[model samples]
Target: MPNKKLTDVEKLAIVQEIEGGHIGINAAVRKFGFSKSTLMKWRNRYRLYGMEGLAIRTCNRSYSAELKLQAVMDYFRGELSQYQIIDKYKISSRTQLADWIKKYNGHSSLRAYNGGKTAMTKGRSTTWQERLDIVLHCLANGQDYSQAADQFKVSYQQVYGWVKKYEAGGPEALRDGRGRKKAPEELTEADQQKLAMRKLEYEVERLRAENVFLKKLQEFQRGRR
Candidate 1:
């Protein structure tokens, strides 16, 4: 059975039961069908703030930008791990810490990652222009998707997906609403030919660069003789 969301009252009662030694935490979790982590979270909250800490939050709490940056800096500075940050900040999960780090590192955005109404959106949305800009920047800088994501305020997955689409369909492929089952509008014959030509041009350019590198390597080898 799926784990049910426990109310604050229910959580407090369970914690109290365990604290009273009526049942061990492990046994209570087995009997109640709750995970050990869940019980541990409840116990921790209870210990820190009593019943008030277990209160069910109706809305997601928003952290200030400064707080988010501070947490990320702390992690980056090796001052603490995600778990330690959670305890220090009274945060509910390590995932929140990670999201803060991603946003601070320019791999995500405050608007996208903030625990707002639309926070549940799977990934950040990007326009075709932004996609093209990211792709071009990555190519120009010789950056992989991860590096591009960190430099461009986008997810690595997004960068990778956009590059694949651009390769398969050229600039036109970077348009929105990809991966959906609905067929996109038909491209003109000229547009189809243009995409093919663009792809070929990119491949030729890559090959030329590789050829130059190989020639340089051969010269160095010959000079070592």
Candidate 2:
């Protein structure tokens, strides 16, 4: 696993501090903000392999798509927590594993996740239907604007704006406004009622789908057990 490049003298000092019995390992970790496992790994390497093992190596390493998928599957199978998987696989960062899991669950392509290549980032305009779908999906998943932005590969401001517009005007609010004079922001009482009705319909549909998915997931878990 790649670590921040520390000088040889700094590495030896840290190892000495831990070994000198002047401070507990937990105190050293709290003071340095280093992971316990990381500190232990460094200490062991310094002891067994001398100063060379503690030396910073090249940071560039690549994991194949299949390997990433397998790691995610092992995580979901309840075999180990993310930190444990990191230690087991000698992964550099837990966030890398998390990104893999997110892509797998979202059914997004590896290239899209790694390259941040998405329709929203490719200069393709979104239709009202697409906007509505994104908004509803975010709401259904109980995602805040930031999480929605990451999951949907849109800007945080875009998700925030869409949600505000959706709450005020429902589906009609998402319609393209290009080359058209802006309408008044105020909605009539009847329009407000229609918006509320449409929002309720969206909520009901999302709940129904969630229920079915949960049932199927439970059945699958039972079969696995």
Candidate 3:
């Protein structure tokens, strides 16, 4: 929401060009280097509230739990799409609304917004088990990395890195590798069996998490269509 790149006048000019057919949306996106979604949001906001809507807020805005709940409920009523609900409630971005919907669906409590005060900006040391649990929580909650980071008191980068690493190389990849790796001959039969079982369990968990994310994405897309 804090877009220092474009001012209100500049935003209005671009929106007018797109609206007046002087430039197509795709061409505007290519020329202005803005995402299609961002451009479309500007156009919609301009239509709904004129130049006032396009003006960026100077300060951080906070929403109450009741307001968030109302907006989410309106969304579930199926009367308006995400953008419409966003425009109706003047929420900052679609991503924010999607996060709220994920929380609602996951049965997580929606507390009053405090302008992201609870988020950690710096990374912290974590063990392999803690990293794995954080990644699992993030994936299970539809990849809500911010929520996971806040809940675990770790930086967002750490949570994101762990999730990506796990997806690419499985659980063992999360290890810091500060210690020497055990040679194949150093492992006993029971040790090998335990390692294999843990790998299998992790794979199942990864697949289940992916399935949950895919289902949520599909549902959202279907609703939009």
Which candidate ranks first by TM-score, i.e. highest? Answer: 3
Which structure is stronger by TM-score: 2 or 3?
Answer: 3
Q: For residues 63-171, what per-residue lDDT tens digits would candidate 2 score against the true structure?
A: 6544565466568768798767766665555667788778766766544324443322111367766677778767866745545665666654467678788788666
RMSD of 2: 11.3
Point out the higher-scoring one by lDDT: 2 or 3.
Answer: 3
**Global CA lDDT of candidate 1, please?**
0.67
How do the residues 1-225 of candidate 3 rate in per-residue lDDT, one tens digit apiece? 334589989999999999999999999988888889999888977876788878887764577655676677678768999988988888877887898778777756666767434334457899877887787667766787777877898765578778988887666667897775455556688856866666567568778877888999999999999
Ranking by TM-score: 3, 1, 2
Cα lDDT over the full model 3: 0.76
Candidates ranked, most accurate by lDDT first: 3, 1, 2
TM-score, one value per model: 0.42, 0.38, 0.43
- The models' CA-based lDDT, in order, is 0.67, 0.67, 0.76
Model 2 compared with the native: what TM-score?
A: 0.38
lDDT by residue (tens digit), candidate 1, 11-88: 888899999999998898788888887787788767766787799877666664435544655676587877677777
Question: Which 10 residues in a row give candidate 3 its minimum summed lDDT?
Answer: 113-122
